[model samples]
Target: MRVLGIDPGLTRCGVGVVEGVPGRPGRMIGYYVVRSEPGEDIALRLLNLDRSLAELIAEHKPDAVAVERVFAQHNVRTVMGTAQASGVAVLAGARAGLPVETYTPSEVKAAVTGSGTADKAQVTSMVTRLLQLDAPPKPADAADALALAICHIWRGGTRAKIQAAALAAARRSPR
Candidate 1:
């Protein structure tokens, strides 16, 4: 399955596309960072983010979209911006008719690094090792986006199978 992972932020939104199945190594298809100036109006910033995400979605044609869920932050402005960026990502996925799932930061870290409390450096190290890249992806946002994709492929694929099997069993069982 191909998945587009989004790490949303008003200034630097990270995007990564990954292809793989459950219990197998995954490869990165593409990675990009969408930038918008804070000096710009919110509307324009959102538009820029939307347009960039739309293009990425069209280019990648992912089966699913995994977005980093916005969590509460000490700075209200920061939280608001992140939430707005995240909304744009979900909208893009819906427009493309793809399943969209949101994973919290801790969840993503745990899936990629085997610990929810893992630091960014730890997560980056694991992502570099897992993708077998000579070096870690530049800019933490890109690495975070790739981590989101890897997490989804490893976790979502297994979840999907379990749901499908349950549905099949329910269909065959007597009510």
Candidate 2:
């Protein structure tokens, strides 16, 4: 399955595409960071982010989108911006008719590094190794985005299979 992972931020939103099945290493299709000027108006920034995400969805044609769920932070301003960007990402996936899932930072870390409290360096190292990349993806955001994709492939894929099986079984049963 092809999955798009988004690490949403006001200034630099990381985007990554990975393709693979459960229990297998994911191959990186592409990775990019969508940048919006901090000085720009909030509405404009969000619009640009939305447009960029839309373009990526069109280009990659992912089966599903995995986004970093917004968590509370001390800085309300920072959290607010992240939340808005995250909303844009979700909307882009929904607009493209793809299943969108959000994973917390801890969930992504645990999926990739087997530790919910893994640091950025550890996550990057694990992601690089898992994807068999020559080097770690630049900027922590980029690695985080790829990690999110890998997490979805590992976790979400299994969930999807189980759900599909249940649905098929239900259809086979009497009403």
Candidate 3:
């Protein structure tokens, strides 16, 4: 499966493409960060993100998109920007007719590093080893993006199946 992972931020959105399945190592198809100028208006920043994500979806042709789920933070501004960027990612995936999955930071860390509270260094190290890359992806955001992809490949499938089964069971049950 080809998965595109998005680490969304207003100033620097991380994007990564990975291809592989569970119980096997994945290959890094591409990884990069999309930058938006702080001086730019919020609308422009979001627009730029949307365009960049759309371009990536077209270029990579991923089967699914994995986006970092924005959580509540003390800084409302930061959280708002992240949520906006994440929305753009989901929109891009939907526009391309691909499945979109979301993972929390802790879920991503646990999937990659076996610890929900793993530090950035730990997650980066594990991601590098898993992908067998020469060096860690720079700017942390890129690494995080790759981690998100790895997480989805390793866990998202099972989660999706479980959700689908639950939904089917619910539909069959009496009200």
Candidate 4:
């Protein structure tokens, strides 16, 4: 399966794509960033984000879209903008006929680093090591995107296997 992971931010959204065998861990395909002017109108920012995400979806054609859940207790404006960007990303995936999935930061961190309380540096280091990249993903946003992809790979595969097993057992039972 191929998955695209998104880390949403108004000014600098990050995206990463990974592909793997149906039951195998995700392997990196690409990672990058999308940026918009910091002070652009919220509507315009959303529009741009939507467009960029659509382009990425078209280019990658991932089977699923995985995004990080929002976590904020301060900077309501920033949080709202991030949510808006995330919505646009989900819409893009839906438009491409891809299923959308979401994971929390702690979930992603734990998946990648085996620690729910991992900081950005820890996640980045692990992502780099896992992907065997010469250097860690830069600009925080990109690293975050890669981590989301990894998290989904771990969670999504487990979920899919459980679903398949349940279906198989159900079929085996007398109806």
Model 1: per-residue lDDT, tens digit, 1-175? 9999999999999998889886677988978999999899999999999999999999889988889999776378698999999999988886666677789999999998899999999988998888888889868899999999999899855554454456556657787
In the order shown, the candidates' Cα RMSDs to the true structure are 5.6, 5.1, 4.8, 6.1
What's model 2's lDDT at 24? 94
Report the number of the highest-lDDT candidate.
Answer: 2
lDDT of 2 by residue, 71-169 (tens): 787368688899999999988887676777889999999999999999999999999999999989988898999999999999856564554456556
lDDT of 3 by residue, 1-175 (tens): 8899999998999998999998788999999899999889999999889988999889999878899999887378688888888888887876676767889999999998889999999999999999999999998999999999999898747655555456556657788
lDDT of 3 at 107: 95
Question: Stretches of candidate 1 above 4 Å error?
Answer: 158-175
Ordered by TM-score, highest first, the candidates read 2, 3, 1, 4
What TM-score does candidate 4 reach? 0.85
After aligning candidate 3 to the native by TM-score, how far in Å is the CA of 43 from where it should be?
1.5
lDDT of prediction 1: 0.87
Number of backbone clashes in candidate 1: 0
What TM-score goes with each of the models?
0.88, 0.89, 0.88, 0.85
Which tens-of-lDDT digit does each residue in 27-139 have in candidate 4? Answer: 78898898999777778888888888888888998867888888777478689888878888877766665667778888989988999999999999998888778888888
For model 2, name the residue pairs that clash.
Answer: none
| lDDT pick, better of 1 and 4 | 1
Which should have the higher TM-score, number 1 or number 4? 1
- Candidate lDDT values, in order: 0.87, 0.89, 0.87, 0.81
